[model samples]
Target: MPKPATENLIEFLSNIPFFSEVTKSSLKHLTTVLERETFRKNKLVFEKGSVGEYMYIILSGSVKVHEKNHVFGHMHAGECFGEYALIDSNKRSASITTLEETHVLKIYREHFFQLISNDIGFSQGILSVLIKRHRNIDIIQENLASSKKALELANSKLSGLIDGAMDAIIMFDEKFRILLTNPSASVLFENNDVIQRNLLLFLDESSANRIQNLIKNDLNNDQPLSSNYLPDVIKVIGSHETETLNEGTISKWGDNVTSFYTLILRNIQDRLQAEDKIEFLTSQTEYLKEEIKELTSDHGIIAEDKSMKKVLQLVNKVASTNATVLINGETGTGKELVARAIHQLSDRKDKPLIRINCGAIPTNLIESELFGHEKGAFTGATATRKGRFLLADKGTIFLDEIGELPLELQPKLLRVIQEGEFDPVGSSETIKVDVRIIAATHRDLLQHVQDKKFREDLFYRLNVFPITVPPLRDRGNDICLIADHMIAEFSRELNRPINQLSKEDKAALINYNWPGNVRELQNLIERAIIISQNNSISWQSIIPQGGIEQEATTLQTSNTIYTAPELIEIEKANIERALKRTKWKISGENGAAKLLKLPPTTLASRIKALGIERPI
Candidate 1:
């Protein structure tokens, strides 16, 4: 009784489970409410979390049910999707996408409910399908939860292993864009913002070129996704433009459409430095030994005066400790001798004692001389060289003339003292050393701090144990002893028969203020020995006629004579002046302690000893 096309539609509806129990009359009525829709392949039918308003049945092609990028199931022709919409108006549990160009019959929720309510048989049949789908959904949810939990556990373990690795691990795409990086990789590159950046940005030109070639060769050869070890080391440049040698492997993964690469690297900078350090220290030690033999007397430091004995006592007390010593004295007063004594007595005596004169080096090169530089860091930096700090690792470094250290570079020295770490000039990587520091200076560092020529913090850091070497004039009778010792040595060296100094010679030497300290006495003795006649030294010839009187007059005019009590008063006054200048601040950059070039604790002790106090 129906048209041919209508009869075909009725037959299709009759075969479906929902309408199988319905009467022939109901099947004919269902065709009127069903709407036919067509979709292109890969077209989105409905997205997860969207409102569900219609139920669809595949009529010609297949459709995929997925969440995010993972496909869970597929439905071919004669299969139904969005069936839950007929029972309730909840959000879609899964997204539907056409796997191919497909035709589908869609029924609105209102029409679907009307057909179920109008016919009891159809309603029973629909309920049966709903119960079965519910059971299937429960099973799928349990399996999905188990799979999600397993995936999370696996990912966590992998992440922990990668993060805990000491070697740097990085992941990148075919274009060399960074996809992920571990903490070690971040530290090696010296950059935290490496993600989404090009890998070539962190490598030197040669390394970048080589890496590109390697990748191209592998791709061109159609090699399978596998790892390949790089035999040669690669040079990586850090954020500070410092270069380091890294050894590692590169691996490729993923299909042809989307390729990924993983780079695993280990930094070998420390190992290379260790090898170079041994050679450098061996040479440096031999050179220093020769220098020591030439400069020092056979009997070592000759001291007899009470002041010199006290200086030696202080040196002995502090030599055992790793405390930084600041030897304050005039030039030619044997400050280097005191430094050598400390190093020779310390626990680190077995290690090298490296000395660097801050003022002796040029201003432009002093930084490199202290912290070192990489090759090509600047003009003339042809080969990488270790600085004095690196060479003095586990040893003592005597920073002579520390007051002359440039103000800009003081912070780096402070970092080394405070943190035991420093970055070489023109390098980003930080190098750590376990070197003890012993600084010496003839300049008044306190005055230098007030003049803003030196860093206050650095002064405090270096002044941990202050040892003031008495000048030649202040050492009392030590001058005569040193003179006699020098005279014997110089006489022997010059092949002169002058064995001793006369009473008059001793008298003149004692009376005259030797402004040049022990060094001047040595020189005078050497000259006297060279020009002596008849195996006798003449004091009159060397002293000139009025030299002693003139020196006495000069000393008197300069008011240089001070007793122990007078000297103490003078020191107290100087500290008070600095305190008042700094508004009685005892610590910090602008504090009185810094102005006086003393540690805060030392300054406080002195203030207490001197009974000095702030204004009421």
Candidate 2:
């Protein structure tokens, strides 16, 4: 006889998503009538081209989800599957097998259909779920059918992303062909095509043979011998020679069960790029910043083109003069650096060069920051203090975000510039001093002046000389020069002495248009440095989702099923899940620090230093 409904636990079923919205009595009846089945490793829960059978609720353990290409995803407890085949009657879209000897709650097709047909809400919900899955698969299929060479080029580009992949990437056949490779993958194989033929066939019967034998024996068994010769996970720390087995389970599949899935090959490279773009755009999202470590004060500040050189000559001509300078450029084009340079080259370089963001400063306090104040000047005035102008007396004051200044303050600024005198709030005493102002704004101040939003006198005074910084796209070999500088900076910061970018890394950085400008370059390098394991940085470490990766996989997930990008996106999601589960603390006994098997301090520092914002 079938086992009794143990512990009268229909209440537990009532809370499960599959049963949550259903009536409690219905849940009880379903549970009482269900069969509990156990499956062992290598057992096919369902197979490709197989008939529609039962749908399973994984009360415990997990199953591997393998598409035609390979293991595309994994399914864990409480998630339902086989519903696709059950409802559609199509061939099993993907083959699923037990990752371990797992116990599952199996609902036969007849009973499942009966329950669905009997309950309107339950039946509709199940149909909705199937529709979504079917639509997703259809989108993916359409994308694959879109082209031939285009798909390969896209996939090759995606594979190029794995060169310095922090997570170890392995592409192995059910037999012994090592198809997948990381930047470091070449370390052992020397040539990636080494995986084309069987390992024994390609090698001269030494290390490859030994590894092949080990792989063959372990995967052939019914149960994964975790303590024995089973293939484990891999973690990389930027060294050319260090190899490791990372945490998380690696299970096998394919007709004979020779294929395996790993946690090491996360799509972090593309995802990190996406995160940087999102983070960079949202300036206040400061917890995870995207301002890549600038290579040098000189990098990308001045353009080499003659047209750009004309602008620089103008900046230098007014550098020694006391006249105010207005600097303008697209955001992220190093306008701020030009402002600094103007101050450095000026006569007042010896004194303080006070930098204040007129826009960033709150509207309520714009006046207080620009003019010195006495005690009891306002409600929160705790003490007398010198404002930025007072601090910048006998020197230069850089007024960034000048366009954001209210109309009320523009005239006062113009007065201060013309008269060299101003009184603080609630005080009659006036201080007089000589200060040259350098104002920089991404906004068109002239347009503001036209709208009477900016003071014309102030504009005329500040626009005496102008400097326009060039974007990265216009820079020449300076690209490699900057890249070289980044190599040194990142290598030292990461404590890994990466001497050069792989040919691919150099090419991608040079060809791609850096919308974030020098800032984007710096962020990419910072991320690569944090995760890079090579003596030299690899192309894989720096490929981001926004650049070429997006061009290839950007639309892969939405209404379409672009597999690689979609999978990478999913990987990014899982990392967020892991970080959330670990509470953003990558280290410590209960943290990812312990699970990654890294020192708590190391993991904590990495989390902090890398700016990983958990998806909570």
Candidate 3:
């Protein structure tokens, strides 16, 4: 036999200080008019200066009484606020904000007046509660006055430290309105009139939002007030809209009656600029180191033969102009060397000569390698990277094996050549670079276009000024000239003291068909120098026994005219012989592919097409 819900509510209301002297009937009537409302933490129940029509009693949780961003006192469950509103209609003197998720019961001023007029006990109960609240408010005002005095003294002492600090310091209220600033802050902002202005007015939108959210989160969580440095540099707009980068810390502090935030900031523009300069210098130093290494290894171009001299002449002719040069040659036939020569002789010689082998890079990554990618563009792409084309800005980019560039990426490459701009991987923003492109490839691009493997438009664009480099076999007497130079270079490197190639070695080198071209010759000379005895390199020591002579004899002895099909058969037979000699190995120093002076990929393709397979 429990009481009904209405009776229980009436009993509960009677226990409250506001209803303690009220009659049971008046208390029951009061419960009928009481409206229940729930508020989230940090939600405003009522604002100072707003019209107050209801007095609210907290049913659960707590709230803070504040005025103009200053927390004066706290009200807990079973306590009431806005009581003055029920008595005499006036604007709220203080704001009530929930400290946690709160439930409150509010009574309308009309209902309160009606209750007071009809019931003497109800009126007496209301009078008693108002008198008690008035006394408590007087005590609280006295305590606030004393706290304000102490706070002023503390601020006076803190002002000295804040003013003396080199970093700009500013104090702000909850609304981000500047309350105080030190001399350094005025100097930093380049304005003495920053006080009372919103701090967000001086910051960019992103920075402003970030700071607002940070402060609001801290306040809502009731976290301990402490100073901590912001994670990144913020862009600040100073007087006359001048922008500057600044790093700073924000701190929250309060006396019992009021809370405030302080900002400590330092300008980092000059430091960042100096760091950028240092980084640039470091990058330039590394580039110079690579250039020096290249110079030491190969002493420029040794072009004694007419064909090579003609190629150098073309390089010199086009070097001064900003023209796209297409170099056509077999693999290892000094195409990259010609590209380097073009870059060195041009005005961009002082800049970089960035080189990338298009065929060497994986098909999946070739696009990113050439055009770069944004951070998080793909899996494991943790940071933004500048591409080869971007790095070659105002310089030259040598794209070796251009024929192998993927068909999907060809249009982008064409755009760079035509419009001087491209978009990076996973980015819509287009980047323009004033880079001169020099493309080289062993494969016939025209054939590729005809076969629909390469775009005709892109091929035509790249073939603007074509230069053909003769293979090492066709370079004629340049072999001896290059050999002598390499011998001298390698002699110094290995400390072998071998300075000359024997007459027989020179003859054999000239007679051999260097399918791998200059690269193979360079490797041979270096190996010969490494194993040379008595300051002399013999043809026998470098080549397998009678291998060069047998190949030379076969070529010299072949006088029969052959059809296209017969020629293909002969070429296939020759490759099969070489592969068998090398035990079917296709790559590396002693591999048949290297011996035949062909790229392993090219040899593998030929083997597959010729239906050649390793014997079990």
CA lDDT scores, all candidates in order: 0.82, 0.64, 0.81
For residue 218, model 1's alpha carbon misses the true position, in angstroms, by 8.7
Give TM-scores for every candidate, taking all chains together and pairing residue i with residue i.
0.49, 0.41, 0.62
TM-score (C-alpha, index-matched) for candidate 1: 0.49
Model 2 bad stretches (over 4 Å):
1-303, 544-616
Better of 1 and 2 by lDDT: 1
C-alpha RMSD of candidate 3: 13.2
Candidate that beats the other on lDDT, 2 or 3, i.e. the better one:
3
Model 1 off-target regions past 4 Å? 1-212, 215-278, 282-299, 548-616
Which model scores highest in TM-score? 3
Q: Write model 1 residue lDDT over 490-538, tens digit each, in one string.
A: 7777788785777787777877676556665665566667667788866
- Can you list the residue pairs that collide in candidate 1? none
Q: What is the alpha-carbon lDDT for the whole of candidate 3? A: 0.81
What lDDT, from 0 to 1, does candidate 1 have?
0.82
Error of 3 at 224 (Å): 4.7
| lDDT tens readout by residue for model 2, 74-108 | 88876767765445667887788888888887777
Clash count list over all predictions: 0, 14, 1
Tens-place lDDT per residue, model 3, 162-242, is 889889999998889899999988887879998899998889888888788878887776555588889978888888788
